[model samples]
Target: MRGLASASVADQLIDVVSRIAVRDLATLRRYFPALSPDEIADKLVVGTARATEAVGAGVGTAAALPTPPAMPAELAAGVLGAATVECKLIAELHVVYGLRAPGNVRQRAALYLAEWTEGRA
Candidate 1:
């Protein structure tokens, strides 16, 4: 069922985001020592935009190729990819601002998901 697929996707995304490594302050500093916060944010925004677009394009391509029954799976994959990319962007922006959430990974991930949901609403 569609509902089942959606719930599975949400659970998997929560697990993935909670575990995925986002750049920390020190990591960002090492890689972008010369960049200002604004510059870092611009980079993050650009990268996120590209990744989101890629996910959209992937879904579009799959829709053009797959049978109707396969279309839903491709749709779900698109949703998952977009959410993961957006969550990573949110986490990176928090780092750029020197305000990465202070909690265990799961708690921090929940905050990012909440932010994502809020933005969608």
Candidate 2:
């Protein structure tokens, strides 16, 4: 039962993360008025890599809080934090490229989650 409950919570968390819109098309375009979609995606890729590395690194990262936790706790935090960052990157890339995955928010989220897991934009 405990394991089941943990799984349920993790699923819910993933759903929420996937559904959340990190940015919209208009916002991305407005933010990068001078850059093409490909250029914007390039910048995002670099930023995401830096953020992911910060999350995985042990110290000096605000993204992974509760410093000095046990190994398991740190590991979990790093995983979740990096996932959140990657999701944001994927969402933003979709917006920049003017590509919306067809379906409801949940379905789109699932697609994005799959892309993230597969390690591609």
Candidate 3:
């Protein structure tokens, strides 16, 4: 029941992302059988770093606030954008391999997000 204002949001975000990384390693290998998982992971790591930077930049523009209650909408938007990029990467990989996911884009993203959250417990 923690609100967005909780400091744990950052920790939650990191935990979810780490879980996604571990899960996606196997997923990428499955979709791109010809490619090395390590290499793909390296590229993804680089992309994630860039996305993180973008989000940081977005958050930096907001006025200094004591809590997330004062956080700017742009910051939330930036985080959402980063999440979208991560999800889209997975979807696009399936498309590239001619593999049809079982559901629509939102459903597929939710499935991936669920995998990410599974590591929380």
Q: What is the TM-score of each candidate against the true structure?
A: 0.86, 0.73, 0.47
Please give, for residues 11-81, the per-residue lDDT of candidate 1 as tens digits.
78788889767998778778778999899888888999999999999899989984899987898789778
Q: What is the lDDT of residue 26 in candidate 2?
A: 73
Q: Which candidate has the highest lDDT of all?
A: 1
The deviation in Å at residue 67 for candidate 2 is 10
Q: Give one digit per residue, the lDDT tens place, for model 2 in 42-117.
A: 9889998998887777433543465555655565666677777888898788878778777877777777777887
Model 1 worst lDDT run, 10 consecutive residues: 5-14
Write candidate 3's Cα lDDT for 76-119 as tens digits: 65665565556445544444445545665445555655543453
The lowest-lDDT stretch of 10 consecutive residues in candidate 2 is 58-67
Q: How many clashes (backbone N, Cα, C below 3 Å) per candidate?
A: 0, 0, 0
Candidate 2 versus truth, CA RMSD in Å, comes to 4.0
lDDT of 3 at 36: 57
Each prediction's RMSD over C-alphas, in Å, is: 2.1, 4.0, 8.5
Best by TM-score: 1
